[model samples]
Target: MTAPAKTYTLLDAAGRPYRSTTKGLWGGHRGSRIYGRLDCPTALLALARSTGYAHRRVFFTDEATAAAAGFRPCGACCKDRYRTWKTAQENGERWNP
Candidate 1:
């Protein structure tokens, strides 16, 4: 039989690596440190551009993982969470959302 497919490992909120057969639940832009759903419009548009967004694209197992990595939620797609994060930042409160 052929060799089995290699599984990918992604980081959890605590930065622990875990194996997964599928891609992570969230995608992040390394430069901006922003995370969003896999189908996020901004990501899609960026990827479609001439330069493409793949070079800066990162993956996270979950929102908590992304947050722990210092990534904020996407404003275009995650409006509510972005607002919460922004408010927390402006008020000097902890960013828990």
Candidate 2:
């Protein structure tokens, strides 16, 4: 008999949750709506400190999905993307990615 396949819960472009065999490529905070690398230092620090960040943790299939879900890039991990997002926000323009 074959064992059941493992699955991970990830958020879609619409911020809806779904189960997939593939793991998420990016991580985010649902409350803050900020996404970044799965190995982001700031996120890891928060996780280590047990600041309830894990309770609001979310996972994304990719950056595009995260952006489409109304999430901004993390300045600590995704500096270049965060700069672009920040500039767009400051100029009252929508960020494409």
The lDDT of each candidate is: 0.84, 0.96
Off-target runs (Cα >4 Å) in candidate 1 are 9-19
RMSD, candidate 2, Å = 1.0
User: Per-residue error at 13 for model 2, in Å?
Assistant: 1.0
lDDT of 2 by residue, 11-91 (tens): 999999999999999999999999999999999999999869999999998999999999999999999999999999999
Worst ten in a row by lDDT for model 2: 46-55
Please identify model 2 stretches exceeding 4 Å from their true place: none
The numbered model that scores best in TM-score is 2
List TM-score per model, in order. Answer: 0.83, 0.95
Q: How close is candidate 1 to the true structure, as a TM-score?
A: 0.83
> Can you write out model 1's per-residue Cα lDDT over 1-97, one digit (the tens) per residue?
9998778767667655678887788988878889999899988999988465787777887798799978899999999999999999999987965
Lowest summed lDDT across 10 adjacent residues in model 1 is found at 8-17
lDDT value, residue 9 of candidate 1: 64
Model 1: clashing residue pairs? none
